[model samples]
Target chain A: MSSITWQTVQAEALRRIRTREWPPGSRIPDEAVLAAELGCARATVNRALRELAEAGLLERRRKAGTRVPLNPVRKATFEVPIIRQDIEGRGLVPGYRLLTRAVEPAPAALLASLPAGSLPPGAQLLRLRALHLAGDAPFCLEERWVNPLTAPGILVADLDGISANEWLVQNTSFTGGDIAFGATNADAETAAALDCPPGASLFVIDRMTRAGEALITSVRLSYAPGYQMQAVI
Target chain B: MSSITWQTVQAEALRRIRTREWPPGSRIPDEAVLAAELGCARATVNRALRELAEAGLLERRRKAGTRVPLNPVRKATFEVPIIRQDIEGRGLVPGYRLLTRAVEPAPAALLASLPAGSLPPGAQLLRLRALHLAGDAPFCLEERWVNPLTAPGILVADLDGISANEWLVQNTSFTGGDIAFGATNADAETAAALDCPPGASLFVIDRMTRAGEALITSVRLSYAPGYQMQAVI
Candidate 1:
């Protein structure tokens, strides 16, 4: 045998759990005991166990030690890629067409979600509507709002060369954001853009980004029918 | 002023990113330099930076050092919550009705997804269909397949008191799994169960769980209209 690395420790522990040797909700040996049994340092065992704990397979407490999770709600991590990259990754040509550009008052829902003092009352926000394409077919429709105070240059920025989604990712500085996924029945305007029938179910991704305490942008992307997102846990 | 802790270090770093002090695609100071500047240990700075990197705000390479991510596609982490907990958390009484249960030949898709040698040829699998409820209204419909070889006791187990979802989590030990989210037009049977019109869009979650080399279960959960999932990044 070579040596007991953290990877090997993790694999062995996983195998034991899978075989019911350490059944669900049952406490496992302490880190020191595991380290001694595996002939490894306690730190190595601790690292391995910590990873499993973070993955929702094991639960740990200060004095109670670790136990296999009874109701393990596994988490799936997804990288929310930009529209162009997502399309290009599938061996398709990515393109976009800018449809509408105007200044408008922020909607009530948008105003409610924004942080207090982030935007002045009755401030005009730059609104843009565009269609993303995968070569000849429509991929998604983008509706976005840019807060003028957060992105002062957006009003005069070149909107033809690159999409607002791409531009925002490249130029905007945000510390955090929120995203939501849902299904919506396509209205006439969206149906016309995606070439689908009215009332067809479309996958929608809504996002809001913040730069520190200030809201940067809020966007909604409505994808064509049959869009699916997958992840491994 | 507060002493330099990991939280402070993280906050300072986020402030720099948000203010454009450390612009996108710009290399950040190394751990030793940042530690000296902040009057903290290198490990504290390392921990703070690692958290940012994991959150997709920074990218680190061995020789290249850390830099603000050029295209920060912020990740949204979602816990795959149990249906009962989800309903109960919403202050609704959680209930379920077992619609169908039978042993049948594995479907082609199920057989295809299962690992070779995990099951014998022409094996009978336990298939289940059930309706989960929030109060008296139908919440979602679940269709599941349990590999008999991996879960031998499932054939005769009392599935009425506990849902197959709950039972699997308690009894099965999975090493890894995959999950997918999409929207599907409900078929006649699914529409009947959910009390919706046929061809109405339904949010779907498909999952496959594996225990070491053995396949455990494959499940599809189709939710009623207006179901939405949100996450913060």
Candidate 2:
């Protein structure tokens, strides 16, 4: 307690919670009191409590003060990796194939996901359909749309070897983005490409990115059956 | 930038990166210099850049300084909600049914996931199976193992109306946990409860929690086909 850093404070507070000394639904002392006890600044105590709150261990509200969460739904974070790097990191040879590519008007799906004026009507975009592989096994089927405004290089870039998924990450910079995780039944085309039976369950990731008021790219990656994403909390 | 808060500093820096003014792979000015330019404290610039780095938009190294990430894989965070709250928040009537309950020895799956010395062999545990419903529609199937050592009340508690998922959350407190997301095919038993065809794709969530050195509970939740979890960055 003499070395009253936030890390030390966090450890002490976590020990109390884990041992149930400060039991569920109980409200512990406020920041000032805890800081005085620990011989630390109020900011240090606040930082520790704030982290516990973020970890879903404590719930803090104005006037009500901080209390152990009655229902602690823990958080688990998994990184969203670049496709090529992810495959190669698993000690497998990464490969990619461009199934189709075209320059066309913005699609309905692309228009609906972005803010107004981000992708104007009649705006031209480069559409790419590609398959990524881990060694000889089919990994994922990618359908992507690239807005020429943010990444014009896509208009004439040769994509025979590199996937639009990897290409966009390397060439374009985005200010903000969103990601979606879901499950879907494979259709005829996707099944054939992924070498899976029709109606097989596939894990899907849908991502959208924007660069300073302009929509950069939107892509859907459907993994072959039995894909799992995991992380320690 | 006369009014320079961390928010403003972060905004300006992000705009520069997005517009290619401080292009990717190029080093940016140090915190002291940027803070002086923006007329803010060095702590403010550090805070701003720290957040940008966490968002995968910037890279910070020791003596190497900070730079915009050449391949920014933007992050998106989604909250894992309690099943009842999730259902009720969607304006549906939440319901639960305890399908089965028993006191049994530790299962192989539970033992493998927990830390050593937690859940010793031949330990009698509370096993529960249940179903969560949203407006009469089968929502998810829950299979859970509760460590009686950590939560002894399960032996005498009435689980007729409340699910173990909710009951444990309300009663027991945990120190740490991990969660995993994946896709799996429904088996005959799960398929019947979920009203889905056998071998249909199901979204699966596996979770394990601990209290100090003791494992508290491990559970698996399987959602019927077409379950999507979405979040904005």
Per-residue lDDT of candidate 2, residues B121-154 (tens digit): 7898988999999999999999988888898687
C-alpha lDDT of residue A112 in model 1? 88
- Which residue segments of model 2 deviate by more than 4 Å? A23-26, A61-64, A109-118, A212-214, B109-117
For candidate 2 chain A, which ten residues in a row score worst on lDDT? A70-79
User: Which has the greatest lDDT?
Assistant: 1
lDDT agreement with native, every candidate: 0.87, 0.85
Score every model by TM-score.
0.92, 0.91
Candidate 1 residue lDDT tens string, A50-116: 8888878899999999998778877778878888889988899999999999999988888987779
Chain B TM-scores, listed for every candidate in order, come to: 0.95, 0.92
- DockQ for candidate 1, C-alpha atoms: 0.68
Candidate 2: which docking quality band?
Answer: medium
The positional error of residue A131 in candidate 2, measured at the CA in angstroms, is 1.0
True contacts kept of 2: 0.67
User: What is the Å distance of residue B220 in model 2 from its true position?
Assistant: 1.4
